[model samples]
Target: MQGSYKDKEGEEFWEEIHEVSTNFTLFLIFLHIVGVTMSSRLHNENLVKSMVTGKKNLNN
Candidate 1:
């Protein structure tokens, strides 16, 4: 005489989905960092420093 089994199943499914989404988000963050680092190295620019200081040299 309480919540039905179906409700419990649905809750478990949603929990698993939430876990998967969280893991995917973390993976995306890691991928972005790698991409930024590789790009900085390839371009020979201190991208992270510029981003933190909000200053970039203009060669115009």
Candidate 2:
């Protein structure tokens, strides 16, 4: 907050960098959901429940 970018180039630079950052964050979230779903189906487990309880069954 102590400094400001006075040039158009700086604005464009930050915009592009943060755009990639946003996309990467979204991709990570998508992967997390897919991984949880896959684990639930493949292992016969309720992953959401386990997350809530902070425990997983041995059979799972």
Candidate 3:
């Protein structure tokens, strides 16, 4: 891999790969954060509804 990047073309290809990987990693991280936040919000909402109604709503 080190030797392959000695040429201009290979270097360009490697840079593109790096950029793509970085973007993909950031996207995954963003998805994970969004999932966690949504789950937490749902849990809190359920808790609040349960407290108000004095019963758990599990139908949905």
In terms of lDDT, the best-performing candidate is 1
Assess candidate 2 and give its lDDT. Answer: 0.90
Cα lDDT for residue 50, candidate 3: 68
lDDT of each: 0.91, 0.90, 0.78
TM-score of each: 0.86, 0.77, 0.63
Q: What's every prediction's RMSD, in angstroms?
A: 1.9, 4.0, 7.9
How many clashing residue pairs appear in each of the predictions shown?
0, 0, 0
Write model 1 residue lDDT over 1-60, tens digit each, in one string: 468999999999999999999999999999999999999889878889999999975653
Query: What stretches of model 3 exceed 4 Å from their correct place?
Result: 1-6, 45-60
Candidate number that wins on TM-score, 2 or 3: 2
| Winning model by TM-score | 1
- Candidate 2: where is the Cα deviation over 4 Å? 1-6
Worst 10-residue lDDT window, candidate 2: 1-10
Q: Per-residue CA lDDT of candidate 3, range 1-60, in tens?
A: 555546878789899999999999999999987876687587755654666689876765
Candidate 2, 43: how far from true, in Å?
0.3
